[model samples]
Target: MECERKYRSRALYKACMRAFDTLPVCALVDSRFLCMHGGLSPNIRIISDIEKLDRFVETPDSGPLCDLLWSDPSENFDDIDDQQPEFKPNNVRGCAHFFSYYACRDFLLRNNLVSIIRGHEVQKNGVRFFRKSSRTKFPVLISLFSAPNYCDTYNNIAAILKIDDHQQLSVVNIEAHAHPFVLPNFENGFQFGERFVLYHVTNLLLSIFNMYSPEELAAEDGRHDKTGVELLNKKRLIGTMDRAYAELKKINKITLNLRGLTPSYSAYKELLTRPEIKALVNEAEKGRITSFDQAIQLDHIFERRPHT
Candidate 1:
């Protein structure tokens, strides 16, 4: 009612939708880092395979599209073995195979790439790096989560990685603010345990953003604020989607452990059916918005000049 009255044809809404039509699922930076939300898939042999995909359409139920949008890094020891294939069914989220160290190495070597920088997991420290192996000389996979104090409970800091023309990397951690209202109007509906699980699940699925730390990243390059913050916004859309998928994997683990609270697979299945969850997935598919409140908070965080 309000939308139609505010704009007879919903011009603002339509304009935003069209803006989303131009986005790609992933991007390559200086041909060094494979920047994607989720981890690699068995079906995706080459990066160009992504370009071959038809864009601006509803993501199909299964295929490289679903895997790219939904997969996560495999933590299972059996799957991470270098001698064995790094691909295994991801029982956690129930879609997209879990990728191991060997799998990531193959992808990078085949694609002639360096690191796979993905933002799909909530690290207690804001950012996490998974090396090729305990014996590897350098890190090959970087998992970045830019939401500080995740869900107003995790107390986690948020960070962003900056790679300059020279291919140097730096992570800037944002201090989590005190947000009393985590999910507005949504928490009051469920029971205690249900709400507890739901909040964490929602937190896992929603990826709030952070202000960039050019100074933090500039220690190596000495290039200060030359690249305006506008460039950072471009990465936020894809990064947030990646983080949301990673968080979903976390929710699955949490529910599995708290089986008394949630009915394992049934609990996750129920979660998928949630109207709130559905709206989130839809927006992620559209790549439009993450969270209205968090969006405003991010604007405020960046708008204020950072204190030196």
Candidate 2:
């Protein structure tokens, strides 16, 4: 019976990974295994402890960024078109990881799961879809962007998606448009001067950063010269992964600083380990969470009972 059970367990593990790898964008996202950029809100009382910070920066198996960049497409680079070219921007304005990581956001939108949310990227012109993976390719995008003048000051706006009582989806894809201002050539209320102005300023800064001498802005093989990034070998890359995991599992329950520390738990651990009773607690805590919810989860951490 033991040998047979082992055989079945091994086979089941392989099947789960295979299913996970090929799961459709819809299904992968719909699984409610989620990730995002921004830290959870009620944005008051920011955590200051170093141990707690690790919970914020988890791996794909444990971190938020991995959900965006889990599938390498082919190689492990989730980088977007690196530099800002007019009308074309990198996958993310600041970080390229979102090409794969944003997949989680896409998943959230299509399924209408409210618990998963991210904050780093701005929502200029609202949540625009990438051509390569739109709703047509991956039809649910929770949305992206969070600030004004993001990605070279192109779209300056905020967004909100409303699901009414009737179950109808109302998408606030953009802020209020100019009613009095209209122009056919500009394609909207925005004029030529304001649109390209930010783009030009970015280019000018890049030119200064790259220029070796007068009469030449550094261009590599007719492309913008990439800023230097410290190259890492395969070993270094793998080591970072190990470090992320180790930091996450470090025990803290009996520590002296429990009183001084802001009480919180790891989303990454709960998601990966599937800890007993967490599924119910995590589900219940979904949608905007509060400190009360945090206290409830804290109660479930390694309960040791009385034997008296």
What TM-score does each of the candidates earn? 0.54, 0.24
lDDT of each: 0.60, 0.34
Q: Candidate 2: TM-score?
A: 0.24
Provide the lowest-lDDT 10-residue window in model 2: 253-262
Q: What tens digits encode model 2's per-residue C-alpha lDDT throughout 55-82?
A: 2332323232332332111122223533
Residues forming the 10-long window of minimal summed lDDT in candidate 1: 299-308
Model 2 Cα shift for residue 249 (angstroms): 52
What does candidate 1's lDDT look like per residue over 175-220, in tens digits? 8765543222132224424544654554543333234353443442
In model 1, what is the error at residue 228, expressed in angstroms? Answer: 78
**Model 2 alpha-carbon miss at residue 49, Å:** 23
lDDT of 1 at 139: 67
